[model samples]
Target: ALSMPHGVRMRRIILPQALAIMLPPWGNLLIELLKGTALVSLISVADLMFQTRQINAATYLSAQAFGTALIIYYILARFLITPMMRWAERLVARRLGRA
Candidate 1:
């Protein structure tokens, strides 16, 4: 309010602050989205988990099949989504002058 008039304060101050505060939760939501994608297999979609289930059924190798799925999911989250989320958080921090 002191830095700007009421009308411009929302655009200049509130929105950026809101976005910066939302970054961490937004990253968590992304990770949840990745986990939720596994549910697509319940509807007969041929996602990674679905294929792993099929392989386990065919080969009767539950440990191998499920282990591979777990490893793949870990790699996807650790190498891809996690870094992207961290980068987004850092970018928000920098934009908000908190970095």
Candidate 2:
């Protein structure tokens, strides 16, 4: 048997494997949650969708306003969220000696 404390075993053995298995699905869930934030506009929260609606009402430009909002969401998920998730997954993999 290995001579290690419980915390050391967990940190060195369990967590990396768990994180590697979990990270991909977790990343997808995060992006989905970000998109779901637009629904908060229905409750009168001043979110991106709400701002888009305001722009649409003022200029009567549905495509432009909503399109811009779509682009913003895409940019956030693609540039920020996805990369961060990939980095975390790689870090976990490296820690597990699988990278």
Candidate 3:
């Protein structure tokens, strides 16, 4: 409350702290969004999942097709999305002085 007694403190202090705390859950939401996009295949949108299904239909190899899809999705989430989220969380934590 030292600076301006009440006004700018919320913007300067509270919002950053709140964002730092909320980022992990927001990351989870991102992962969920990635999974949710797979549903777009139902509408004939040729997403990864859709193409995997197509491969399965053509080759009659559900295990190989879906297994490859699962591995690719895992790699995307593990290597790409997860590290980005971790970097964001660390950046926020550092900014908030909680690192």
Candidate 4:
């Protein structure tokens, strides 16, 4: 894990530095994953976006479906991933002062 024998901990080396280093490539992968989610309708997985398409087919609300899918992705990225990343950074920072 390469934890420091001195005051610099592994998380300091990893979280702010390693995570930032990996995030660009990870963001690209995340974008690709989100794009693939659009294809879920073909498999009948019924995720938010897929259900939106189902709603569109049943009703005439294509906009509603797209809007809901957009919200779902926004919530996942903003509420879920971003906060987790921020927390990880903060936690690592806090621990580094002691480590």
Most accurate candidate by TM-score:
3
Residue 23 shift from truth in candidate 1, angstroms: 1.1
TM-score of 4: 0.54
Write candidate 2's Cα lDDT for 14-33 as tens digits. Answer: 87788899999999998999
Estimate the lDDT of model 4.
Answer: 0.65
Residue 35 lDDT, candidate 1, scale 0-100 = 76
lDDT of 3 by residue, 1-99 (tens): 575546588888887888998999988987887776773455576699879888998999999998998887788788888999999999988888888
Please list the residue runs of candidate 1 whose C-alpha ends up more than 4 Å from where it truly belongs after superposition. Answer: 2-7, 39-46
**After superposition, candidate 4 runs with Cα above 4 Å error:** 1-45
- Assess the local accuracy of residue 40 in candidate 3 as a C-alpha lDDT between 0 and 100: 44
The segments of candidate 2 whose C-alpha lies over 4 angstroms from its true place after superposition are: 1-8, 38-46
RMSD of each: 3.6, 4.0, 3.7, 6.2
Tens-digit lDDT track for model 4 on 1-99?
454664466544645666645655665566567656653444676676657778999998888788878877777776765667666556655655532
Where model 3 places Cα greater than 4 Å from the true spot, the runs are 2-7, 39-46
lDDT for model 2: 0.88
Candidate 3: clashing residue pairs, number: 0
What lDDT tens digits, residue by residue, belong to model 1 across residues 1-99? 896888799988898899888988887887787777774455576698779889999999999999998887788788887899899888878988999
Best by lDDT: 2
